[model samples]
Target: MRPFTYEVPSSIQEATSRGGADAAFIAGGTTIVDLMKLEVMNPSRLVDVNPLPMLGIQMREDGLRIGALEKMSDVAEHPEVVANYPVISEALLQSASAQIRNMASIGGNLLQRTRCGYFRDVFTPCNKREPGTGCSAIDGENRMHAILGTSSSCIATHPSDLAVALVALDASIYIQNGAEERVMNLDDFYLVPGETPDHENQLRPGELITAVRVPRLLWARRSTYLKIRDRESYEFALTSAALALDLNGDTIRDVRIAVGGVGTKPWNLPEVRQALAGKPLKPETFAAAAKLAVNGANPLRHNGFKVDLVQRTIVRALMNLGGLA
Candidate 1:
């Protein structure tokens, strides 16, 4: 590890301006600390923001608002989240291990970096790690690489299961630049690995994420998150699906779907959602619409299995949620 300055900021304003541009904000230090040790990410300074009072979960009339610093375990176990946003709770519980879930902050998890071997190994050349350097995962070992929203510069899969669920809810993020506050749809927060694969989000320097809001979607109570991995525990998903359905009698009223472990970001299937809406909630209905989830997927050499895996995962999630499985 490199020698660095450490500062504890009691206020969000202090935290944001505590260190240089290379300074990193630390809440639980679950992701930042590990990457620093591996030399995958090394900041000149570490600014601790745990004491900034970014806490509490609120059930507002508009939505369920979650503090950015809230632990994954706490959010998952919160009765409001569990009762109203079942898929969000399920996704959090299925993420990492119990110990990690207890310590990892919700904000940190949303910003979790790719787990691609080439991206993590500093010795290897990766576009995500260092721009202009070619992505090794593209031609090298890429079984865990992305299939959807991939570019020539990168094919790394997003590793956040919670993000997948949030995507399905069409959540919004509340951000702060000192006192100035703004909110944006969570879907727009993440950027694709277009020409510049290094830039992942829209967070400007010193901007801090304050909270996340999930709008009041009554039908999300009938939602579920399904993940398929090589093993199960303490593993990243090979294919994960998050679905929220609104069924009117035997017909689908509205639906929201997002898939993880197969995309550069949490992949939302608007086409699939559109196809399933108003259609009868049947086995064949789900199986057919699920196929649209892979409309423009560009699978690489080793990760071609994801093309089929994601579809099956989506079908299973929808089936289980609709009690057809």
Candidate 2:
């Protein structure tokens, strides 16, 4: 590992001021530390923001506002979160392990890096790590690569179950740079890997994420997060679905759906949501809606199964949430 200077800022102003091109704001250090050890990320300075007094979980009238430094375990165990937003709590609980969940923060979870093998291996060519270097996953060992929002330049999938649930729930992110603050919808948080795969998120340099705000929805109480991986626990997803539906009697009043492990980013399936809206919650309807989920999917050589797996996962998720599965 490369030698680096570490700074623990007591204030957000100091943290923002200290962050630059060669510096990164560290919270939890679950993802950043691994990359640093692998020589994939060589930041000259690590700005620790855990001491900035920004760690807490608050329930507001609008919805829930989770602090950037709040641990995943805390958020998962929060009574309000577990009861009101079971999808969010379940997603967090299903990720990593107990030790990692206890150590990883919500902000750091949102900023977790892709699980692409080539990117993790510093010796291999990975466009996400270094632009114009090419993507090895494109034609080499791409079983876990993305099927949706994939481009010729890259095929890496975003590896965050929490982010997927947040996207389905219409979450917002709060970013602060010095005294200036900005908020953006979680749907716009991630960018597709096009010509420039190195740029992953919409966050600007020195901008620190203060909190994540999830809007209250009627279906939040009846939502579910279904992840299917190679193993039962402590593994990355093969295909996952985060679904929330508002059912009026037997008909769907509203629907929000986001998919993970099969897309370049947390994918919101508006087409599927639209198809299910105003329709009866039935197996056939779910099958039809699931079909829409994989529309325009361009699967890679080794990841063709994801196209079908994602559809089935979506169907199962909808059925489970509707008490039909």
Candidate 3:
């Protein structure tokens, strides 16, 4: 890692005062350290936010409130989280490894960078790493890259499993810039990789995420997170789905769907949810809804498989959650 000065700010105001283009907020140092070692990121100063009162996991009457600094392992294994939000628990347990989960914070996981090979290698031209430089993955080995919400500037798949589950639950992120605080839906917090691929999220300079709130939903209790990858464990998802269903008898009353590892962001499928809303929970209905997932998919040479894989993953997730399979 590059030589850098570190500061542990006692307050959010002090941290935001030092945060800018040259400084980075470090919590778990999981993502930042990896990029620093690869020489992909070089921040002059590191502002530690671990002591800034951002560590708590509470269940309120409204919903589940997860502090940004809460460790991934703690959240995943929390009794309340596992009982109420199986999708969230499963997503966390399925991410990275036990050692990483023990160290990574919830906020850090949500803001983790893409795992694209080109993006991690400083020598390669990755638009996400250096905008306008070029996206080598577009024409290179891009089997793990994105197909949905992809722009010509970048096709890197979003790497967060927690983000996918939270977006499906319609979670809201609380952010603080100095003393000013704001909340935004998790779905809107991540910007699509448009012309500016380097701009991955909606977090402004000097802003720090405080907590993520997931509203209570009847479907949330029946949710499931299903991932398909090259290996069984300790692997990133090639195509994954976070599915929640509220069923009335054999019919679907409501549903929420979000996908990861196949899009520039956590891809939500409202159309599919709408298509299956009042339908009977059956294999045919699941397949029909799944087909709508790839409505605007722009698959590349080596990643055309994602278009089909995304649909299959969604169907399987729904089946797994609904006990239809």
Candidate 4:
């Protein structure tokens, strides 16, 4: 890793004061360290935010409030989270490895960089790694890249399993920039590559994520996070589905779904919701609605399999959650 100055700020104000383009906030050092060793990221200073008061996992009548610094394993293994939000728990348990999960923070997981081979290997021309250098994955070995929400500038699939589940739950994030604080929908926090591939999120300089809140959706209790990958353990998802359903007898009352490993961001399917709402919950309904997931997908030469794989994964997740298989 490159030599850098480290500072552990005692307060949020002090940390925000220390933040800038040349400085980075480190909590678990899971993502930051990996990129640093590869020299893909070279921050002059590392501001430790572990001491700041961004810690808690509270269940409220309004929602489930999870502090940004909360460890992934703690949140995943919490009694309330496992009982009330199976999707969140499963998403965490299925991510990384048991050891990494024990060290990674909730906020850091959401901020993880893409696992695209080119982005990690500084030798390659990855738009996400170095803007305007051209995306090597576009015409190279891109079987693991994205098909949805992809731009000519970048085709890297988002690598956060937690983000996909949270997006399905309609969660929001609380952010602080010095004294000002604001909340934004989790889905909106991730920006598409459009033209600036390097600009992945909406977090401005000196801003820190405080917490994430998931609105109380009792139906979310009947949710599942299903990830499909090459091997399984410690592997990234090729296509994963986070599905929750609200059923009235045999009919669907409501549904929420967001897919990962196939898009530039956590891809939510509102059209699928529209198709299933007030309709019967059956294999045919699921199959038809799942097909709508690729409405605007632009599959490339190698990743075209994702187009069909994602739909099948969605249908299987819905079936597994609904017990219709």
**CA lDDT for candidate 4:** 0.93
Please provide TM-scores, in order, for all candidate models, with all chains considered together.
0.98, 0.99, 0.99, 0.99
Question: What is the RMSD, in Å, between candidate 4 and the native fold over all Cα?
Answer: 0.8
Q: What is the Cα-based lDDT of residue 73 in candidate 2?
A: 96
Error of 1 at 48 (Å): 0.2
User: What are the Cα lDDT values of the candidates?
Assistant: 0.91, 0.91, 0.92, 0.93
| TM value for model 2 | 0.99
lDDT of 2 by residue, 15-34 (tens): 88898889988888889999
- What's the lDDT for residue 32 in model 2? 95
The Cα error of candidate 2 at residue 89, in Å, is 0.7
Better of 2 and 3 by lDDT: 3
lDDT, candidate 3, residue 147?
A: 93
What would the per-residue lDDT of candidate 4 be over residues 1-325, giving only the tens digit for each residue? 8899999888998898899999999999999999999999999999999999999999999989999999999999999899889999999999999899988999899999999999999999988888889989888999999999999999999999999999999999999988888999999999999999899999998789989999999999999999999986789999999989999999999999999999999998889889989988788998899899999999988989989999999989988888887
Each prediction's Cα RMSD?
0.9, 0.8, 0.8, 0.8
Better structure of 1 and 3 per lDDT: 3
